[model samples]
Target: MKTMTELMESNIKKNYVFSFLMNFRLSNGLWMIYMASRGMSLTQIGFLEGIFHVTSLMMEVPTGSVADLFGRKLSRSIGRCLSLVSILVLIGATSFFHFTIFMVLAALSYNLESGSGEALVYDSLKYLKAENNFISVLGRQEAIFQVSSVVALLIGGFLGTYSYHYAFWASSGIIAFSVVYSLSFTEPPILESVGRNSKTFRGFLKQIVDSFSLIARDRKVAFLIFFVQTILAFSACIFFYIQNYWKGLGRTEFQIGIYLAAGSFLAGLVAMKVQRLSHLLKEKKVLIILPLISVASMWGVALCSNKLPFFMVVAMIEAMLFVAGNDYINKLIPSRSRATIISFASMMYSLVMIIFFPIFGRIADTISFGVAFVSLAVMASCLYVLSMYLLKKIG
Candidate 1:
């Protein structure tokens, strides 16, 4: 049998490219929000983000089923190309409408990514007879991705200081690099059986319906999906608020970059150890406990008077919980319909956020950012309790 290290080495080139692209993509996650704040009102920024979320929600199921029926490599390549185009459009965008167009494209790209790339990697490993090491390998890959985000965010902050457009251009270039890397990849044979029947659009629809029916019938799966959606919605709220909070701390762009980089770097480190963590805790328990910890940490940050403590607490919580939660969700999802399930869950979460984010942003503007944080924390706390009840009921 091929050892895990040997199998990983066999595909190191493709894996590195995928990890780099992920890092490049996430690097701008925070900076983009900060940029939107500069040229628009907070409500407008929230609305634009909501539009992105809406588009992603619409595209998720279709793109996910495409990956399942076609091939992961093809889906990933198309997604990367779409991402490149979106970045180029973002670079040229000057108005809210223009930003909306770019957001739509970006959302579509994210939908394509929902299941394709990671699924390809998983299938590739299985072909190599290294499926047993999926969690560890995935964790390692995520760690690289986080490191890339830290670098990208740092550079993006510096670039944003000069011009926000520069950051978009840089992202475009990075995505192009990803495209080249993706083209060089060879799809594994393990996925050959998956796409045996050439699925028509109607067939795809049937698959989607069947997937939903499965979720509904499997109470464990349905509750897990709901639990994950709640966690993601709260996470989005925290991400949306944190930029404004950092500004309130009298921090510069460089300072903001440093804080983000520190947190992401730590998170990346933790992600590498996720497999070990899995050995110690059940995936469901880890999911619940980590988010609860995140809520408490957010409350601490919101209540803190000092910047140092606020930054430290926020970074620690984010780094520890985000990876743990994601890994847990990954475990719960079935590989056969991974993308579709993930997209379905993401769509539900985004739908919730689309309704609430604008309201929350307006409240933050009229009242206080602290109130926004506190309210979200309270909601997350309630959701955690509900998640526990669901887990028990389902079991």
Candidate 2:
């Protein structure tokens, strides 16, 4: 049998493989275009995205608590299973209702993995006495995500032009494999001590209450969650809707895939360099500047004829924050309820996406994608100012 340290090292490697396999979402780059081809408008697609986030907002915390109480490995494996189911549903989807079903399942799948996976990796590192190296590991993980995304998007885009069904089917196969791969992950031993003591119903409720109470006491944690997640929501909006904008410009699916893959490649490079960049820039300064950069990217994408540069920059910034911001937030919380609190952060992101994504879609449907992006930029700027004001007031 391997020692604890050896076990942890194995967990880290398995996690990287799991994350890579999970992100092979070939359907992502073509979902909107496929729905459009199926006679759904952008507004309808946006509404579907809203449904996803609404489900995530509702289930994120509970799923995170499940990971905290039961086991992170279990949570991750179940998530992959649900994702596989969602993809299967998506392939057969025709009407709005069918799409909504798949979206809800996908959101539930995300809720399970969102916090559990990160917390699992962090705890594994802690066991190895390398918790401090989490950001570096997370950076590499994000880089792997980008690399897989580039490959998946390229293939998906080419296949989707022939038949969206092919892309969905390809994604389903990858997710099915991930479901099995995720099961090979071992639960960190730290969880035995960190999980709630009593296995009763009340213990579950207290675990949740205590997690929320921690957030209530730590204003900085609360602020960090809100600030980082809100920015993430805006960045994700740009990433998805930009496909529509490119399609309107008469770009082929393959060409658009290449464009998105380039952005992902650059983002991967930035993710890999996050540790060095954070050392040079200071994490505090990076956090402060990130929102500003996101705002500029949104505006540039909205107004400029050449939008690729802005898109790539936004992708890079998003990847950087995933590494740095999570490291900062995770340090402020305990392992016992770490997944739950992180889920709260994701819930905040979903809440923002739920409110804004549909509205942005409607605006695009009514006017133009450019105008919708301009609105996003304006909203992001106002939110940034508000977050700063709140930070100062709280400080």
TM-score of each: 0.89, 0.97
Count of backbone collisions in candidate 1: 0
- Per-residue lDDT value at 209 in model 2: 88
- For model 2, how does the per-residue alpha-carbon lDDT over 359-395 read when each residue is reduced to its tens digit? 9999999998879989999999899889878867766
- Poorest lDDT segment (10 consecutive residues) of candidate 1: 189-198
How accurate locally, in lDDT, is each candidate?
0.70, 0.90
Please write out the lDDT profile of model 1 over residues 1-395, one tens digit for every residue. Answer: 76644554566546865786756753364444544555867778778889988897788878888877776678878988888888777766678898889889888888887667666666666666666577777777777877887888788777766666677777777888888777766655543343334387777887688668877877766766677666667666665567667776676666677777777787688877777876788676676676677667667756765534544445444544545544555556556676677677767777877877877777777888878767766776787788888777766
Best by TM-score: 2
Candidate 2 backbone collisions, by pair: none
Superposed by TM-score, candidate 1 places the C-alpha of residue 353 at a distance from the truth, in angstroms, of: 2.6
**Model 1: lDDT to the true structure:** 0.70
